[model samples]
Target: MGQSTTPVLDRVGFAMLSIIMISVLVTASSVFGTSSNPKGVSIPLQERGSPLAKDGVIIPEALARLAYWDAAKQHAKINNSGPPNNSSSLFRRHSAPLESKLDDILWVGEIEIGKPRQRFRVDFDTGSSDTWVFSSTCVAPICSSKNKYIASESSTSTLQVGEFKKDYFDGTEVSGPIYADTITVAGLSAEGQWFSPIDQVNNMEDYGRDGLMGLSFMSISQLKAPTFIGTLLSQKKISKHIFSMRLSSGSGSELFIGGINPSKYRGELTYVPLESQTMWIVKGSASANGRNGFNGNMVIDSGTWV
Candidate 1:
């Protein structure tokens, strides 16, 4: 035989996970890449006084935003803000006075969807009952206008955006739905989490995103049949009796999918039965707020007030 070549078979599935570190995630950690800089901030000046330079000067607004973005990124890297293989690497808490380790908040890495859009991370919410993105259909001037629905890629596991109706326009609550679209984050796929399903006619850009993937451990996001926690349970990823939220502000909050580190908290976590209407509201006294200030019924979230 002159030459024999065997075709090799590859078996690993390709999961394209887009991790978007929210500006809020900038609360802690310091890892990053230069590619992350905004094009406005990175634009090189041919000469100091070029017309694009605005009187031989850098744009103050751009500079300030860049500075803030940079700081947030750096904070995350320093704190090792990311998922853990085990439970040990999840958080480095800070309990002060009586216990500053009390203020440890958990952070989830979010993915920025679509180009030239307002970027936001998806939180696993259990407190709220709606899922939305900074989409075009959102008429509130405060909402991000650059958001868009992403559907060009093949989704082995992905979100499906649905019909939209306008919510507001010109400071008036008009009739437009938030709509639907697919969104994925952290290599975890929760399909149909997005909103807004209309094709572009007026302005596809008008509907910023299909919508955001709100995957709060609490019951905040609105789903018809399967709540986020309910889905997690169906997948056998967690227990029906217990699921935890370690909402991060910037430094320490994190989301625990299955269980909390026994050593991380002092007393056991007291979880209230989540009502479909309000979501999982973990209750703690004011002292818990002073210490952890996280995971409370009626007023808890992944990102902290800090």
Candidate 2:
């Protein structure tokens, strides 16, 4: 069956779904329903076992055991396969945890870069169009607090001649040198990926994330590089060009890199043509409290709080 646009219900209002660089963020509070294939890879956006698991936050024992079992199976498969062959063939852990303190607004996930894999905690933002991390050269107080990427240490990293500088809407600016490297997320790898290792940051000293992975379009990218989603599609790492995000108040949040998780939502998905491809901005109208009011362009920002 062909793909379709769908929407899901959650704590927030109706959030429509889309494909390609665009994503639909929804949370289901009802019975599950089946979604079409091209159901790409799913990356859990939060840790499975929460620290508050002992404080009335219950994680089913069966689920916990199943996760461990799946990891073991993947490990055994890797051991038998002998040496990684391709980007997609790399060993995949069952759950890619996005570490976030309970009730924290900042949702962060882990991604591995380089040949041997240098892991870094990154804030997946849809508001921006470039991926950047702290460079080994950055010795400032803020950069010192995060995991710095040493490009020279990675055999697969290729130095690209260019500078990457971006000014975010929040008044923070990041500047660094551009490089092409291998970036792996949720066991799916995008090779020869373009990104920046920032040596300077302004007005972002308190930012706890090691980096920010932009899921926006390439049209606005400063690096003139494809967004991570775009590269994945080009490499055929993910069969579909679409991705979905299910952000929850707890550890249940997830980022589906290819397609929608059928079991996550119900009802038909309503499609909304974007105002522009640069960002996931759409024109829409809504009524609240029996008052039919409110219409304009709404930017679906995953990195920000309501």
> How good is model 1 by TM-score?
0.39
Best by lDDT: 2
lDDT of 2 by residue, 79-143 (tens): 32322232322222122124544323445688999988999988777656689989999977788
lDDT of 1: 0.29
Of the candidates shown, which would achieve the greatest TM-score relative to the real structure? 2
What are the per-residue Cα lDDT tens digits for candidate 1 across 133-161? 44344445434443434443324223444
Error of 2 at 222 (Å): 0.7
Minimum summed lDDT over a 10-residue window in model 2 is located at: 1-10
Candidate 2 residues lying further than 4 Å off, grouped into runs, are: 1-38, 47-103
Evaluated at residue 222, the lDDT of candidate 1 is 30
Question: TM-scores of the models, in the given order?
Answer: 0.39, 0.71
